[model samples]
Target chain A: MGATEMREPSFLILTALAGGPLHGYAVIAEVAQMSQGRVRLRAGTLYAALERLAAEGLVASSGEQVVDGRLRRYFRLTDEGEQALTLEARRLRENADRAVARLRTARSRVAPA
Target chain B: MTAGPEAAYRRLLRAYPASWRRRHADAVLGTLLDQADAEGRSAVSVADVRDILGHGLLARLHLLLDVVPGRVRAVAGTAALGSGAGLCLALLLLGEWLPPWAPPSTREAGFGPFLTVGPLLYAAWLLAVAASLLRHPRLARSLLGAATLAAVVLPHVVANAYPYAGVERPSSTALAPLAVLGLLVLAAPPSRPSPAVVAATAIGTVAAVGGPMLPLWLSGGSPFPVRDFFYYAYAHHLAVSAAVLLAAGLLAAVAALVARRPAYAGGALLALLPWAVLLLAVWRRISTQGMSALEPLVVVAGVGAALAVLGGLRALGVRVRL
Candidate 1:
């Protein structure tokens, strides 16, 4: 979609990596859990996002390893990425606050206030 | 504990690029193993293997796309270079082989010498291709086309200009076209980047023993050397030049690995190696006796090419301090 709508998944991905470096599968799992299972990521979709972020110099590759006969790669967010993530989170919180106030006002009117 | 699963995992890992694997393959595998251990012995299944394979492939593909810009249509220039190179190679082969097989009249009429058409044409073609490359740039095809065209024309020009008649194959004359060709070899497009990787287990395969095999079929030279202008001036010269280029290419590739910047490494090796080798040869000749008559013009051309590249890069907004 537009730039305004594109920030959600990126922010979520960065947040998932913020705790520490995480492999592809771990990042997907962590993000889903952190979002209360509201944001399950497909392998294609998650890696696609990871690639874009890496190109932008946001997320850097930490390392890779094999466990249980599967290859995995770990990534960590850069300082610039962390700052951008912080800004996005704040912007989102502000918007959410405005929506909650608007909903409250609408409920009062519906209650005959 | 299980060798079969580990081997399978390593095979799956091989799908990624070597550079990427160098950085992360081990960590990734370790994490996978940790997860498996946490799940216990009965945890493994076919689906898990499929998921691993699918994810590894996706990861590698994503990495490949990272080298180019995200805009699909805009990046078509690189794609054009690749195709152009292939077409040029095919054309080069046809130009080289078809002339011998042609009627004597056709050969006399310059059908055989038509291979020379490419180099002159390439000067214009390369400019256009480079413009297209830097502008909408077909990443691989444009370069490949230019190189193939150069290969055809350049060798023929050298052959015609200085017949390296048998027993008197002048080293100086023989090195000219090759030196020129070597400068442009790495810039010529490559086949698409390979995705093969190696896993942590099964000895990890960091060892191999094989020399760079010459492109024999493509060369198609007769077993015995000929004293004719065709063999001396053209064939031998081309063969030597190609071999030198092959050496320079290996040097460039190694430099790329060391530098961690493929483009810079390739450019450095291609531009410097030939000039260095030629410069040394020229210096040695001048020290022994006197400079060759063509030295002045060669120097001028070399300087001019450098300036042209500088100007082009400047116009494209790439700053060149020197």
Candidate 2:
């Protein structure tokens, strides 16, 4: 299956990765912001998803930092996550185009009246 | 706020299963701290903490249900028993409610005939229990039933008919019988009911009896009626007797199932012997006092007869059904 078949968290995490490599907390914040404040990932859930994605060779963790005396681990999407995200974006664009075409046809008919 | 929010978060975390904590607790804690900081708050509100904790607990609860072994979860039954015993003791202590049929003569304060007869009957009960536990572990389930009989059921049997001395002491005597029952459980090896038989018998026997008795009991009715006071205490007696008999029968069935295992035979023996002795003693006590005084001797005779019949039937190559 293509990248569009990936889960919502993987999709959002890939979208967050578009900004660049981010630590666990930063990734969670960026995902929420990108989703228009709709998706807030708990650290536990995020780490769990990260662990799975890393195991699947789609994401990799790199370089930990000590911030406020707590360890913060950074994560970066691999070539696989990027390729998957590209496929998903293409699928979304195709679907959006079809819907927009249908809307334009309907709007042209309504405009005459 | 340092201690307060941490304490509040810890309190919320308690809902998570210990196993889940061992695996992912630090990560969850890190998340909570991050969220609080992102919101620019030194302390998380109780409601937010509760929401987070509730989600964690919900996940743990599902894990507990799906992943934990039934035996590990069954230990909660012991806690339930402890709570139930505590509640009963508390209620008994708090309420001065006398037995509806407490004859005026039961309170001869100083132990009279009851001291001698009670202990002996208890001993006989203990013996039978040990025997049953030895011969068939399934019968040991009746140990509690026998204790209940001796403590609750038999007293009602006697109390129903006669003007007994120190009737006021039955509730006090309750602890001894309950102790005897607990000891019997301890003396026996770990006894597990066969799942198939336990499920069938529990539904058929325990539920059959307890299902109705519970409603009656909750409504403040007597469980076992003193026979002579039967009219007034019928509902109570019926409920108590049903619970006692049903319990005894279920235990007996369980003991029988366990008896098939040779390893537990010795413990089962220790458990049964005392029970039998108590039963015989009870038979003796009740027989000696009332028209039922002949009852204990008659039971001894009947048991002998049953044995004789078994022997006779065995000699004739006939299998007699109990």
Candidate 3:
């Protein structure tokens, strides 16, 4: 229940790429949209996270493309990235389950018997 | 219309080092342009600019360390070995052939209570330096810290650690240089200094510093310290240590230039500093009323400062093939 090392933006980016490869802007927009646009991303922040993730072998550049008369470098999750995402998801689920079970126990204790 | 997003983002990317830019520019610029296009950004935002600028400069600093072998540990480790050798030599000089130079009521003192504590400190300190050279940073740091504490504090614990009669217990202050050296090693990040670099720094300092000691020893006896011009033999030896220290340090710097190892040069400066302090203490032993204390300290300090700057200049991007 403790894989909190990955920041929310990084987790979102990795999750966005899990569906397949996406270019830089697509990943940014997808992350923002996934978080209901509450997590807007700047280009610089995205690159920094991408570089860190790439260095950690969690994400990598799949290839490049020329999109709408501009360069688009696509990124995808690696096997390691998928494993990390899986672990984080599991941890999050475990934590949520524990919280829900504890709340249900407390509510039942206070309910009429 | 103002400069497009491409131009603005390209400008921000310039904060990174030339090497990083050369490798990542096109790809990174591509991403920036794509982001700007998709976001419908007419201009760069403050947060975007800040992020790029910060990371760019951070990359530059990392590249600088990568390019230069002159990491802070280079100086500290080299200083550790060099000073260790120099200290041994100075101790030998003091231990032998200089007892007559000792004043009354003190010549009979055999390091007083220091003998018990000094050996352990030396052994541990030597091991720390070895650990540093062996690339065991954690062990080296722990040992160095322990040695520093022992050097700085243990002398005071053992009463009359100095050969001087109770009239003079300079052991605590005397070991200050060793403590400083230890602290330097402990404080710095362990850089990758090849064994060759370490050996060269240690051996070169010894050979250079030892050359003068032979003649002085062979001459049969050390001359008394002179406060006046040309009358004192001790004064010449005093200058001898500092001069050779400077020469050895600069020579090491030059050798590092040849080898493209900036760390060796920095180590030389570190080695020079403690020896300078030891030399001052040696001077104080024989220094008479005629000599101004400030005079020799200034001279020694000037030499030390110059050599230190020479070593540190590598970090300033002076480009000693780093």
Candidate 4:
């Protein structure tokens, strides 16, 4: 709620919804694909995260469609959600950049020595 | 066996609150079925079942926390602090008023005539609570931690220095207030208190205070004066169980009203399952002995059950609204 550190599942869920509105299963599939199958979002965890994100205005109901006689609700990121995602992305990028920079500096020192 | 996975999944989903199921059950179930189909599995995986059950309950608890008002949390926090302090004072007074013929275990650990270590330690705990209330949470937390540590250590020291036969060292009840205060300070955010913290504090305080008092009341009474420690322990457990049930019921009723959702009330009733089982056990024990010590517990159980049923019915589409 305070824009604190987002958990990996939540971050990935937001990432899955970044491209377009996706139904629950689609989002789960996309998240698995995005994480290279390292992180599989279960139905319960996915829904819970979606509910919290929705409550926080990071996501919203785009629409609903029936596929194979079962209802599938689509969720899309709101403007606020997109902004949050962008900020989180920037934060992660910076952290990665700093780590890489430190690694490069250490490598240069070791090589010269 | 054909419907095994779906049925199992549905049963697991029962862990979720009714309101949540009303909204997302169909879609979630569909997704689960889709995943099963995609993975070439015909049954719900053990991992999926565990995930559903674990996260479902947590989700409901999170929702429950969300419905509890900030004002209610603050009030409950204050009451917990007050009750903790009151219990300390009562224990100190009891030590002072212990009759000469009382059991040696009931005697004060022979610290001194007026000023003893236990009272001083409790006084320090009170100061810590006051500090926390005054917004000096860091200092208060440290002091409380120290006080609790002292409480834990002092008993061992006393046991070694002045060992007495049949002297049961002070129970966790003696340190409950400090523990509650510690929980409050730790769980409370800088800007606001979380609902989980408030609920835990409220429930913990009730259990800490009511647990001891109920046993005392039952044992101190006329019809069935239970003097033995065994009976006292049994009565104490019954009282604590009843208190927990009553508290859960009350919380559910209030949450239902505040959230305007009958599901919260139903959840509260669900919380009373253990209490009901405990009540039956108490009834069976007392009924065998022709004892009427169960009247109070029965009343509490009745009230809790009524509240739960009312809420559950309302959630199930009953026309009643309050």
Candidate 5:
């Protein structure tokens, strides 16, 4: 609730909207592409996550348009969303650095030293 | 135009809460259609439907958690206390009703160990409940955790030497320890139970204890004057039924009081589960004994119909503010 940590889908959703405002389908497509098709955002999950993000002030509705007889609402990441994403990225980076450093030390010790 | 993938996707979107659907249903349906078109598919996939339903329900639960955290915790505590007490009492009554020749010593001896461990475990449980009532959340959680662990472990130690060796233990008897554990886990949240929850739990425990004692009191130390009385009169069957019906009535009242609140609605349903288990046991006994189950069956049908009607009305956009 306090942006302690973002789940993978939420992280990707925020990342998807980082570049510019995108409609629902565009955000889904962008997230799938960002995750290299490993994470497919279903309509329900995407919308639910979007709703939560909006409630948390992490996302905001930019506008809406009628595309092919359907309503397409556009959303963009808010300043809070950007800050949260940056914090999460830094946390992940720090964790990864620690793990990699440990592995390097282990390898060096085992390499005929 | 024929109802196609779009229609199917729209139907799936209905699984979301009404407020959620009102805001995002069309948007989600549009996205689903776009995804289907991108995949060159004509119908919604099973995975899509599963995702919709699973996420929708999770979102609803999250909303409930957000709205009524305290009420939810109180309901959980009440459920744990009520069910755990009911199951322990049932086991004690069952031991009492076992025949003289059927390894009675094991049960009698079992009580010695039970008296030793039971009081300690019960004291811990009481302290936990009291702490919860007094708003001492940390104390309540710690005591509940210890009491739950002791309860789960003590049963095995107390009944180690075949209390039911010569007799076929009713499978339902095995649910007691599990119920105790579940009750503790659910009720151990760091929140004070409301006055209504406390009152309901006390009433529920009293009803549970009194239900089994009613038939004994009625029989007045003499065997019940009816055929298959052991099955119906002295076997705790009537007691369990009475207990279940009483608990169900209480839960129904709570559910009605908090009809508009999703958290209480879900919690009330969860608290009614012990009653459901007891009802099933009674139904099984009634069927096995070939007794007139018409009355009980009618009660079950009536409750089911009422729930179904409520659900249907809710689905029809009726604001269930009862």
Candidate 6:
């Protein structure tokens, strides 16, 4: 059966956690801010990503603590995670640069401006 | 307790397996309640329900995949390797591969169907098993498959062409050789998705253990007619049983390569213990009589027991490299 997929919001999630370890709700809020309110990660979507990331060794549990009378489990990026995120960031930047360069060439050719 | 956001979300949280819920439910519930508080809401949203149910089932599937094929098939592969090797050893020990007891026609020169097929398949299996041990599993698999196909065709060649052997119609493709063919196929491992590997392993195992005994079953618990090829006596019974234990150890070793702990091997050994004992217990009688009715049942039971033991280990927080 074809699986219904949640679009991977791992980049923004990793970017949010890059600053430090954060609990589930704090991550949701941080990702919202990081994405400039463009990629809103719901609780279900966030946990699913976190679970997959944890399984893949890209994320790990930092600790659990009590915050505001509720238990909050904190997650941190591992060294491997940092490496993966760095590689992805570099790749994405390279592609963006290439695209931008191509667009300038196209613009110059179209109107000679 | 009251019908509020926490209560409603708690109901939604039931979608996850109990173990998963235990680990992550409190955090997830906390997050959901926090989201609800920020939105000034008291009821669950449609999107929340959809994601929860969907991801919950997905998580359960992931958990099942981790336990089932991951360890069991690896163990089965090892066990099958043992069985394949054990069969070769048994044949040599019993003098069945060119058995001295056979009439002169069944000798190496005569090339009676089993005489030729048994040694060839077992030799290929031994080589494949060696290759697999050396971490050349892909090469081993190719050799094993080629050997099995060759074994399948050889019976016809030896039986039909070699009329000088004096046996009018040879059932070389019948029981024991078929089992060995099955072993070679099984020990080879399949195209290597865990499920496919497991299925191929299961079929090979049935053929290895049951293929030989099917003739005995048909013959109404009397000695089968084809003694020149494979002597279905004490040697055969002992070999089959030994194969079970040896193969169990082999797969467990493969698992240990991933687990890196001797305890993983111990788990597989413990699983096969009953089956080995059962076969040993009945083999003497089987050698004297036709075939033990319990042989097939014993094999299936042994495998089930092994899968259960490993699966239980997985549930108990013993992690494998899957």
Number of the top-ranking candidate, with DockQ as the measure:
4
lDDT by residue (B1-322, candidate 3, tens digit) is: 2357778788888898887788677777777766665667778877778888888887776565544344644565556654654554443443232333333332344444222335456656667667766666667667667767877776566565223333222254346667766655554544444566556555654565455555554443323211111123344454455556656666666677678765555555555566566556555544553566556664666566655655466554545444
Q: iRMS for all predictions?
A: 7.4, 10.4, 5.1, 3.2, 4.0, 5.9
Model 6 clashes, total count: 5
Which stretches in model 5 have alpha-carbon errors above 4 Å?
A1-4, B1-3, B56-104, B107-320
Q: Report residue B114 deviation for candidate 5 (angstroms).
A: 10
- Which 10-residue span in candidate 5 chain B carries the lowest summed lDDT? B222-231
Give the per-residue lDDT of model 1 (tens digit) for A1-113: 11233356677899988999988778867887888988766444566588678877889988766654566778999997887777777778998999999999999889953
Q: Which whole-number lDDT from 0 to 100 does residue B240 have in model 1?
A: 31
Higher-lDDT candidate of 2 and 6 = 6
Best of the candidates, TM-score: 4
Rank order (by DockQ, best first):
4, 5, 6, 3, 1, 2
**TM-score for chain A in each prediction:** 0.84, 0.86, 0.92, 0.95, 0.94, 0.89
Q: Encode model 4's per-residue lDDT on B1-322: one tens digit a residue.
A: 2467777778878889898899989889888888887888888898898899999888676565544333333433444444445445544443222333444443434444312455666676677666755566566667666766775566556452233233333333344334534443333222232335334544554554445554453343332222222233344454454456456556755776678754444444443433444454455555655676765766667565656655565554544422
Residue lDDT tens for model 1, B1-322: 5765556556766766677668655655555454455456433445556665676676666455443323221212222232233223322334333334334432332323443344343344345444443443354345445544555445445444333221221234323433343224323332232112101100110110001112332333553122121223233333233334334434543555476654443333334333334434443444344435545644554454445334433433443332
Alpha carbon lDDT of residue B59, candidate 3?
A: 79
RMSD of 4: 11.6
Q: What CAPRI-style quality would you assign to candidate 5?
A: acceptable
Ranking by TM-score: 4, 5, 3, 6, 2, 1
Give the worst 10-residue stretch by lDDT in candidate 6 chain B.
B167-176
| Model 2 chain A: lowest-lDDT 10 consecutive positions | A1-10
Give per-residue lDDT, candidate 3, residue B290: 53
DockQ of prediction 5:
0.36
Model 5 residue A83 distance off true place after TM-score fit, in angstroms:
2.0
**lDDT comparison, 4 vs 6, better candidate:** 4
Q: What is candidate 4's CAPRI-style docking category based on DockQ?
A: acceptable
Candidate 1: chain B TM-score against the reference chain B: 0.29
